[model samples]
Target: AQRVTQPEKLLSVFKGAPVELKCNYSYSGSPELFWYVQYSRQRLQLLLRHISRESIKGFTADLNKGETSFHLKKPFAQEEDSAMYYCALINGNEKLTFGTGTRLTIIP
Candidate 1:
């Protein structure tokens, strides 16, 4: 079974500080990893994908196959960056398994 777990439900930090959102997954076969984000009232959008190796909105994530993790990271958090983040895994069937999600609040 493929599953994603986001240990933290909420992560609060001040603006301009580093932030790391933890994510762990379990899967038997090769999986595609992704990070999705939803701002206050906006639709969920793709933040980054392991295959793309691209960073979006100052955020980046690396797939750690050995540790079964894909943690999201940002060097400088911005107030506007505060939003809900979900870690997801695409299984062989192309079904995305999402974590409960973490609400990140960046204090100004």
Candidate 2:
């Protein structure tokens, strides 16, 4: 079975501090990883995906096969960045699994 785990349920950082949301997965075959963010009163949106190799909102994540991890990182945190982040994975069968999610809070 494929699964996604987000170690942190709640994370807080200073306005300009670095932010990292840990994500680990368990799967037998190659899976597609994604980071989804949901802002206040907004719908869930895609932040980034491993295959794209792109950075969004100053945040980037690298898929480490050996570690089976895809942790999201941002050099500097912004107040607007505060939101609920979910790590998800989809297997070859197109079955999607999501983590419990992490709520990020930015403190001034």
Candidate 3:
């Protein structure tokens, strides 16, 4: 079984400050990592994926296999960035596991 862990349940950052949401996973096989975000009254959407290696909405996360971590980062957090962030993993079995999620609040 695969497991995903998000160390923080809530995170507050000042506008223009850097933000990081920690994520760690435990899986035996090579797995895919993804970051998902859900805005107010909106459906959960994909933010970024390890496979794509692209940045979305000024946020980026790198999969660290050695550390078993995929931490979401943004150099300068914007007010719009305040939302629910979830870290997910997909193992070889095609089962997706999601962390409890962290609610990011950008303070002005």
Candidate 4:
């Protein structure tokens, strides 16, 4: 099973509020999970990876092997953080499977 799921299509958050974007995956082997963000008309770029254990643009994600989940989080939502986010899974040599994505809007 190689699949990535993002349940939310759109998320609205006020500035300075915490935000969370959920992601779930299913794979047979050790899979790599990634979060990609696309701002407006810009191309999609890698936001963070489960293996990196780092944060990008104030966003962080922790991979929970026990629950098989990788949920992106930010302590304070900013206007720039508002974008289309996609959860992806890479299983072995198989192609990357991406979720439909979630559009986040930060209301000032």
Best by lDDT: 2
Candidate 2 per-residue lDDT over residues 1-108, each given as its tens digit: 888999999999999999999999999998899999999999999999999999999999999999999999999999999999999999877777999999999998
Q: Which lDDT value does model 3 have at 99?
A: 100
Q: Write the per-residue lDDT of candidate 1 for residues 1-90, one digit (tens) a residue.
A: 788999999999999999999999999998899999999989999889999999899899999999999999999999998999999999
Which 10 consecutive residues of model 1 have the lowest summed lDDT?
88-97
Sort by TM-score, top down from the best: 2, 1, 3, 4
- What TM-score, over all chains together, does every model reach? 0.97, 0.98, 0.97, 0.96
Candidate 1 at 79: error in angstroms? 0.6
Task: Identify the runs in model 3 with alpha carbons over 4 angstroms from their true place.
Answer: none
lDDT of 3 by residue, 1-108 (tens): 789999999999999999999999999988899999999999999999999999898888999999999999999999999999999999877777999999999999
Better by lDDT, candidate 3 or 2: 2
- Cα lDDT for residue 69, model 3? 97
Q: Give per-residue lDDT, candidate 4, residue 15.
A: 99
Candidate 4 accuracy as TM-score: 0.96
lDDT per residue, candidate 4, 1-108, as tens digits?
Answer: 688889999999999999999998888788899999999999999999889999899999998888889999999999998899999998777688999999999999
State the displacement of the C-alpha of residue 64, model 4, in Å, after optimal TM-score superposition.
0.6
Report lDDT (CA) for all predictions: 0.94, 0.95, 0.95, 0.93
